[model samples]
Target: MKFKTSLIALSIAAAITPSLVTAEESDIEVITVTSSRMDKPVSAIPNTVTIIDREQLEQQFRTTKDLSTIIGNLAPSFSPSRQKMSNTGETLRGRPPLIMIDGVPQSNPLRSGGRSGQTIDPAMIERIEIIHGANAMHGLGAQGGIINYITKKATGDNEHQVSFDVTMPNNLESDGISFGTSYSFSGESDQLDMIGSVSYRNNGVYYDANDQMIGVDTTQGESMDSQSADFFIKLGHNFDESRLELMVNHYNMENNGDYMAVTGDKENDIPTGAIKQEQPWEAANNQVTTTSLTYTHEDIAGQQLHLQFFNQNFEAVYGGGCWSDFYDPSMEGNDQVTVCGTGDNGESLYYEQSRNKSVKWGMKASMIANNIAESGINLAYGIDMFRDTTEQDMVVSGASWVPESTYENIAPFAQLDYDLIENLTLSGGVRYEYAKLKVNDYKTMYGYGDKEIQGGSPDFNETLFNIGASYQINPSIRLYTSFNQGFGMPDIGRVLRDGDSFPDENPSIDDSLALTPIVTDNIEFGADYQGEYFTAKIAFYRSSTDYGSRMVEKEDGSGSFVVKREKSVIDGLESNITAYIGDYDDVGVNIAIQNGEYDSNDDQSVDTDLDGANISPNRINLFWTHNFDNDISTRVQANFFMDKNFKDASDEVYSSFDGYTTVDASVAIPVYSGTLSVGIQNLLNEDYYTYYSQTVGKDTRYFKGMGRTATIGFTMPF
Candidate 1:
């Protein structure tokens, strides 16, 4: 591990040193980020943020459709990619970040089923904005900040335009051939503009470097042997001083693999594989539909006003039942009986499928005023309200895993931007939130003896604040600092499902089962240097919480888990440097280092450092790109992960992950009013294991990463 770390460090050092020449004038376009209520230039913002434009996305993320993998590569603070459909252990700075599409939240905060990261297809995204560290602007679920995906918009004066794109694997293997196609039409008139697109993709089976079938994890919604479709439409009309816009997006994805997992021998370095099997009762499915309406008034009594209303419907289903234990009344003393597929009558029963459904609606209204009272102050205030109902159940048995529950939240926030001096600016915000949850009485499932559980109504209220300042010392140098607060509620469903005694049997339900919210305080300091040929950024941040939420595995082998709260602290450093050598070539390097600790014994003392489950290992990314004169471009990239020991070494259930590096390359060429691209993923064919597969103790989850695969794609416009 130590030798591998040193090798990676040397490689990164060699790649950056040669291009660290003197700065010169360059023609870099300015990027605007919408992290705040208003769109501000990235150079002027005090927070650490990264913006990936359409060009970058098309060039860098053409080979893979995983959003987590794409974002993790570009952002330093973000954890390494899971390379799967589910983002179970992916975190930003040791905590989960809020995901949004067009300013509408997509994360299921109530249950957090680990499917939020895959809510939308990469083909539908126009740009992605990521804000690092804790923030209060977005209210709940922003404990580690926000990642907002902006959809495409109509452009140009053309009355009508069409575009088509197709991509497929170049490998000859029939089972490894994946294909996707998309068609889009956009038009703009004097007063109206509209854009719409429909896309469908069919994925083939996945194999490792050894040409062995990858293991199927029904619980994680594996993408292999799956099909997905996306539909999107947006329309906007302009008035003299007001504008109205509407958007609708639908996405459906499901896994229909014909194979089941076969556990491996981890001690012997053997990976889990798949074998042919009969189809289960239900395959893993993820579907979502969203609709939104937005209205904006440019000049309303010298204040700009914006109003938006949105609704979303979502459902996700997992694989069939594995194994569980239940109390059997047929026994003399009601002894617990373990069952895999047989019922009380010793007859075979269909495997039970677990699923969750959610319906959410929300509204937001905000107004911005400039030069308030001639005090050189810009003020922005907003009100947000949302209602969400979610439920979890077993389809085959009609049993409840999580009872139907409704969550209502209302928040009011205000932000101030003050021009402190000629080159310095000060910004601050405050927000107050009120939330309520209501649940009805329900009976536990077979696993819990089918006991009736009492329901309750709970309310939570909190106030959060943030402040920051940025100073432009020179034309090419800027310094910034910020202190922000963010909060998150516990997964109530997890708490309720672990109920051991009913309210009647344990009268102190409120005190014994009620979970508390977690509040985080983050402090960050950073500096940026932008020049014609060289650009660099460095940031350091620390976040602490009196109570933090985490998932703990169950000892009963049911593959179920519960959420718990404890004291936690996390701190990290991020740095990135990019140098452009002339007009055709560029080199870049990014590094991230993080550490986390928690009070495991609840003695007010931090007793253990966090493992891969909570914190990501140190990582470094390096890349170089060159553009030829004939409209051809090529890029080579590498990512390195450093070795680390798991925090819970005393627990035999934990495993330590070994460090490894991977390489990738791609080429793009322009042809006949279109672009043709060829890419090789896992160019080195490292034959390594994923972070989750390496660190997980169980054999069922042990699997190797994807092998080297070639892809070819083309896009044309008419």
Candidate 2:
């Protein structure tokens, strides 16, 4: 019975949305046996798990390589893309998830720069696995969930592939054109396997529906007028009882600053526009390099042992503007009036940019013992250790925006799984974390009143646990429930950089509100049903945290300021249904319904509904796919976001978020021994602002969605 249910996932290989899973717990082959850090069946995963296989991923890649867009369309609970380089406001289940690649962390939770998603090109990835609720399985920073990108391996037969894709707006103008090219190869010889790939993309200027130039998001990052490249390689050797693999990945995205953003009138529905310029914005870039070596032994005293060591280097640059907080770095006394000289009207001009830089290295060692004591019980135990050094520095001024900070963490965990009976399974795990952060005292920024700020080492000790149960309700249905806890750190850099957060005279080192760690606990239950022609799933979850972080835009509009607030509660439901017509045709619908609120008055009671900044409105996606006799396949999907309106604790209405809709379609046909694919974005040319732009209501960042566009690609495998 379970084996039949597992066939659903293998059969619906091209499901575009977050769809059904393969319940191959013990009957069918383990579908998720690679790159999962922990070797286990998909059923062992407690919460909802969405697997985006290569087929669906390539189908999405036909339209756009922007991972955020792909995720928004595929993942049910993922927030809408901000349509910028930064992933800010792109929370999962109302909280930031831990983003990783090949079991290596890519997210910088300490500073929270929101650039994790773009660390690697999607072309190098073979699949994506998302765990829907908070958990400590991956160690730190899973307050929301986990998004792990599994890279392609070199274990297949000798193969080589090359592909090129080009995209342009409906007008077919040269300015709004983009192109990408990639070459990849994999070969297996004897005991050795090797794989490598290189890819490059160039994006031209972007235009809105009105045929106006879209403003460049210099502040975060932008895809417009940018160049991105990726290089990846992995080598592995198989031993009689062990396997060793070494991998390296280098990625870079640099924005070409060729225009200046001109603010618009939000009240009048005018979008921010851009004008051509040759200014120097070389500072706008994201560079990441990661390397890891893994060794696994299957015969270690009748147990499996996995060991890995990894290192990552990251740097990100944000646009600089002459704000009141910026000071001339050449001056010794923090003179504020230097970079952008006074204008004719005695107003400040734009000046310097800032960069977030960090280096991280970590190691993990784990052992799994099956059939412990012949009781049909399994135990998986491991220890994780990592260190990260992070800081934010001024790009042009060569000054420090946030002082150098170092963090160290060591954790040990144990997980147990047992089939209590033939029809019931129980799983539990525990992890203990010991962490420390060190920062030296430094003078505050000019906006911080030039006072000497005190910095000290802050340490933490925490323990998190998760438990789950699953019961087979006959052959075609399975029920699961879980309680999971996660731990994370606030965006310490936000408060530390703001001088206003500290008081004068004997300012104590303790600022619990902004510096405390955040802990979240989630309770979830769901059911899965697999039938001959119908597959469906539904999950409900409630998550809460005593101390959570929230961001509020400043009055001057320089940017947003972060604060640690009271209790926050998030409740949501995710469900999807798909009907199949034979093997090559299917129709599906997925919906995510969520609402979040927090205690605004600090009175120990929830009072305010979270705004768009922290939560996403309800969303739905509908799609259909068909394959004809001529080996031609076509897929179409439409996404809709419902309107959202909420108020603060004070009863002031904020963020009257109007809903919007977009449609996309793609087709692939066999041509000359290769596949020729074409994709259309905004097929109906529905003009609208992004959810972020519509909710924020800021003129400078009031960005409109992209206009109608088309993409063409050709792929050949040899």
lDDT of each: 0.76, 0.81
What are the runs in model 1 whose C-alpha is more than 4 Å off? Answer: 1-30, 159-171, 325-350, 501-504, 507-509, 512-514, 649-654
- How far off is residue 616 in model 1, in Å? 1.8
- TM-scores of all candidate predictions against the true structure: 0.92, 0.94
Candidate 1 lDDT tens digits, 1-718: 0123443443343211112123552322246676678666776677788777777687775566668777777774676776666787788888888888988888887777878876777777899888888887777788888889999888744533333333333345787777888888788888789988888888887777777777878666778888899999899999999999999999999887577888888889888878877456578889998888999999999999989999989898877654444323333222232234665566433445678888989998999998888887889999999888998876655567888888889999999989889889899999898988887777666565466666677778889998999998988888999999987877777776665534457433245434567788999888776777667777788988988887777777666777767888888877777777888888788787887878888876666777676687788888888999998999888888878665642444344779888787889898888888888777887778888778653687887888777778888777
Q: Which candidate is the best by TM-score?
A: 2
Q: After superposition, how far is residue 303 of candidate 2 from its true place, in Å?
A: 0.9
- For residue 260, model 1's alpha carbon misses the true position, in angstroms, by 0.9
Compared with the true structure, model 1 gives a TM-score of: 0.92
How many backbone collisions does model 2 have?
2
lDDT of 1 at 330: 37
Best by the lDDT measure: 2
